[model samples]
Target: MENYFLGLEAVHPSCLAKIITGDKLPKKAIIWEFTNEIKPIDLYCYLQVKYGSPNGLQNFLRNDSSDNLIHWEWSLAGQFGIVSIQGHNFRTEVHLIGEHDGKGLTLEDFIQQIKADFKNHGKSMKSVRVELEKWTRFLNPYHRINSVVAKNIKSLNSLDVKVDEDRELVKFHEENLPKLEENWKYVRDKYDNAIGITFGLRSMLPVLAESFINLIIFVLAKPEIKKNERLLQNTIRQQIDIRVQSLHLNCIGFTRPIDYTDDVCKKFHTLMNERNDLLHGNVEVNKLKIGEVYFKGKVPVFVGYEDMWQSAMGISLSSVKYNTIFDDHAVVTNFIEFILDHLSKDLKEQVQYIMTNSELGYNPANGRLGSLFSDNIADFRVSVNEA
Candidate 1:
């Protein structure tokens, strides 16, 4: 079993020395949860037992804060329990302590901080809470930035324009973007050095990046509805316009163009409402037995991968407003592959034109490219000519 220790930290060490941890209103505790089971010492000992290591449990009581550097001592663990600890700015602090020692940043300081808090609460300084599941699942809060960055990289890779065309979009958004990548190295270290568990780093980060870029495509393709941009705007009046445009079902453009045609638009209106129902909340599903009921078997099937994840966790996105920013990104990896497959054809030429010509403009969901990339857009690619 993996032993995980989550340390609570106040804003400053002076704040910690003054009072108790987790005792008052508005006292924010940033929990630093760490997991390890490799050493001879048990998890509980590392947490509750005091006096052996430099930052061992007892050292948090020292009235004087200054002391020689102890790798596993108060500096590392004592940061916690400071209810009013004040500082203008603070990074993870994981990087700032004892950085030169080859041991890497140890949890000793964090441990001492927690111990101090234990003392403040009038509780036994020799005890700590070590959770197995929460600590070891590998939910690295530290990785949040890097994961987002990886997504950005993938987003850039999926732009639907020729090399010269993509350069234009890059030139536009690159400068306007914010630098969200602060403390990106913590993520790098955890992925590189942490032990005892397998966490798939590439899973959601890549998907997030792709999904974001796809949403952008959908927004860009809004002006051109003939190709299925209507599938996205999917409102009643909008759907009808697309249907009429696609099938020329109604000569709305000419035949009595000015007259209100609710009759012609009814089917679209109903479907549009139904689509809203399905996308916005729980969808009722039932199975029918046709011809013969073979042995009366009963089983369950969850719809959509995201839906399944939600079901398992009792959390869902049905009511959440769809982010238009991510519309075309969902289909990018596939579309990029699609572009690769058609790189030698009329399609590729069209992409180059749409992407390169500032007048043409580029949309990830450009209907012309969507048809070719359809769904799976990542399988093919002979490096796009860079702008």
Candidate 2:
């Protein structure tokens, strides 16, 4: 395993005066952070055009295998440094390595010189804008899917009431009930369709919640857990409840575990049970009752029957109501908020910003100014470059 150290904070253009005071360059690599307006790719392209290929004295080499928009190397004063833009969160960094003969010049002067060079020669790169637009298009479908689900649930509830009313009318008119088989069949068909939608939505809710929870883990898991592929896989494979509880320990390092008594946790546990019952084919039989009917010209008829209705199997689809779907969705949101509440102020702010705006790209206005770094410096170079 390669040893790693925390690199010096990258001097942002705005903080140069206060931070970069001395001529002595940092012993460790200095990570320079940039905004979306000026991405590392934009800088790379400009340098490529100005300095040609990376083979020359002003070497500029791009890692074609890297998923990051800006995973490249540029030689400044004969020393190679990495310039990378993280794909997951669009956090840009230029890791300055080794030393330069700045003589009496301070680090501030060197940064100013680089900015001047870019200002004089660099052209705007469309990569950042294009990537943001692509993400926007990707997210649009999810919004439409959620809207359709809500609309279908509303329709299902309305149809459910009608089916119940039809059943009641058929029971009261027992003599004509046999003759109304076609009407009953038609009603059953409509009921089946509406109820099928609810079942499908119910099954999907747990899946969506689980996926989101896994996403949070992926984003916020401790460095030790993330770096060990086997450990990460094991953690993910654990029960959903375990994974949820582990978030407090692994990410936030809280000695106290997440409170299962909380409403959010209660809802999440219910969703997990539902998902398990569905996947494991746990059939729960529900009894349905019909009232006794009296005839006008004959002895009163009492009709009673035993029926097996499994909610998970859609035998009792009515059991999975709109509120169930709503509650399942609410639990995911609530659980996210619940976890956020436990995080430190800085971590909570960063995590919230990343969760909300990562799809769109990083926006400094929403939270902390610079890129969020993991514990391992090598991770800064490699993990962020992966898709």
Candidate 3:
């Protein structure tokens, strides 16, 4: 059994100074020694080629999507010492492989599958010129998916509003918004600002996240096909990722069951963007201020804790089950069960083994009461004859 420590770190400026000699002096830095078994892909290099940073490393090979403009920051401890990487979309798979998928899917791999499918099956909106236009230049954009709200849109038809009339689409948006609005009351009335104050609301966050993931999966699921659904779905994924990252939020689980089409994904993304704006202190919309948070890019907005608590409860009602439970309180319990489900069966086995055998073995501080916890020592260990 082994213990994995996950915590923040403090860096010594003298140690970092040598590495960043020609660069700016370090003031506020979050540096740590990298000790994970898995090797890290150079995010700056990845971004320079993948995103085309205005100033990339010298003699670095350019990647296919060099036209993309993404920026973010990441740090690691290489063999030499500390490595700090700041740029956009510089993410490597924190998603462990073989948790749910025996073979984890990479963006490159997904793209290859789409290209193959396109070459073979094809879709209603396939064309060479369209193919060139539809390809992704960057995974992360500074403005984020929500930033494009100010972009040109000839009509909602492009957005797949499902209705022929523009007014009907707007009407539908107005009608469904009450759910998100009502949720605010549930969360805001409860906890004040605390680290985990909105932890429960993270579940609802995935509702939006999964919707976006569905869009990416939609594109990757297809072959070289250029379906109208492709870009729309990508929009959903892009918007959701940006929102999640911008809010500095994390998900408790990921469960999206969308068929994955471009148009469907776009619709959900659009809905989430509007919701984020209204919920995060936005005042432009009539009566929006009575309750809600407004989203301002680069400006961190925190939702009322009470609104999220209720949404968390609502999620439980929708998920979790043990003899078909009912009642509102049950929703939270079910949601907990659901978030635990985020750990795949394989990962759960790993966690269980680590918890029981490792030094960190179910810290008394974090586990359930000893009485409530099963005395499985004899069950999993020596099979004892009952006295």
Cα lDDT, model 2, residue 292: 48
Per-residue C-alpha lDDT of model 1 across residues 5-40, encoded as one tens digit per residue: 234232334543434333442233332333332221
RMSD of each: 26.2, 17.3, 27.4
Rank candidates by TM-score, best first. 2, 3, 1
> Each candidate's lDDT (Cα)?
0.31, 0.51, 0.31
lDDT of 3 by residue, 1-387 (tens): 011111112234444345456343322222222222222322223322322332323113334333222233333332223334333222222211111122333344422332343333233223322333222222222123212221212121133322124222223265646665554453333222211223323223324234333422322233222244564344344554453332211221233322223343344445445445535646564533234666799775756544333354333322221112122123323332343344446644443333232122112232211111221221111132322
* TM-scores for the candidates: 0.17, 0.44, 0.18
Evaluation by lDDT, superior candidate among 2 and 3: 2
Worst 10-residue stretch by lDDT in candidate 2?
1-10
- Write candidate 2's Cα lDDT for 1-387 as tens digits: 011111222233223322234444343345555556444555555555544333221113333432334444333332222222222235545444434223232334434555556655544433333432221112322223445555766776666545446555444376756766676566567767766777677776666566656656665677787767898898889888888778776664343567877888888788777777766777665323223466768866545442322222234544556336556666766776786677677777766655443232223233213223321223244322211
Candidate 1 is scored at a TM of 0.17
TM-score of 2: 0.44
Q: Stretches of candidate 3 above 4 Å error?
A: 1-190, 193-196, 199-207, 210-212, 215-220, 225-274, 278-281, 289-387
